[model samples]
Target: MIKKAVRMKLYPGLKEEYAKRHNQLWPEMKKMLKDHGAKSYSIFFDPETDYLFGYLEIEDEERWAQTANTEINRKWWDFMADVMETNPDNSPVTVDLEQVFEL
Candidate 1:
């Protein structure tokens, strides 16, 4: 399995909404992530900077990218765009993070 992490900026003052949305995430979206070999997905928020950090474990990077192209993922992106920085297609403007150390 490969571990991946990404960073993005969240819209100011939307932390609560962001957390609430994920807390009530759709079932279909969850299933899609699982089907795409995604495991232990998590998101962390930095209150001071409003930066969002996401991490996940995947079996195949290619499959993971393909999974995000699904309708469920698209819908999730659209739903989240209101509280996060997103592109025209509703995808977050993400910065890939390099893994330096893991214990």
Candidate 2:
């Protein structure tokens, strides 16, 4: 499996709402991630800086790429656009982080 890390910016003062949305995450979205080889996905938020960190492991690059094109993901992006920095397409403005070291 390959570990992926990404970062994005969240709007200030929406920590609770962000957490609430994920707590009640759409079942289809979760299923899509798993079906695409994603495992142990998790996100962390830093309220002070409005920075969001996401991590996940995936075994297949092709499947992982397909996950981003799903309709459910597009809907989820639209649902979250109001609370985070997003592109015109409503996808979160994410920056993939390079791994410098691994134990």
Candidate 3:
């Protein structure tokens, strides 16, 4: 398994709405993630900077990347574009983080 971390920016003043959306995440999206090799996933927010930090463990990077092409994933991205910094395709503007140490 591989551990991945990424950073995303949430629009100012949309924290509650973001949480509410995730809290009611669609079942199809959740299933798609699990099917695509997400063993564990979590997202943390920093209210001060409106930054969202995401972490996930996956079976393989190639398998994980394939998730992006799924219809459900695209829909999910579109669903979240309003509350996040996203690219033209509505995918979140994410910055992958490198891990320097682990305990």
Question: lDDT: which candidate is best?
Answer: 3
Over 1-103, each residue of candidate 3 has an lDDT whose tens digit, in order, gives: 8999999999999999999999999999999999989999999999899999999999999889999999999999999999999999999999999999999
Best by TM-score: 3
lDDT of 3: 0.96
Local accuracy of candidate 1 as per-residue lDDT tens digits, 1-103: 8999999999999999999999998999999999999988999999999999999999998999997679999989988888988989999999999999989
Q: Count the backbone clashes (under 3 Å) in each candidate.
A: 0, 0, 0
User: Which TM-score value belongs to model 1?
Assistant: 0.96
The whole-model lDDT of each prediction reads: 0.92, 0.93, 0.96
lDDT-based ranking? 3, 2, 1
Stretches of candidate 2 exceeding 4 Å from the true structure: none
Per-candidate TM equals: 0.96, 0.95, 0.98
lDDT of 2: 0.93
Q: Write the per-residue lDDT of candidate 2 for residues 1-103, one digit (tens) a residue.
A: 8899999999999989999999999999899989999988999998789999999899988889997799999999999999999999999999999999989
- Best-to-worst order by TM-score is 3, 1, 2
What's the C-alpha lDDT at position 77 in model 2? 95
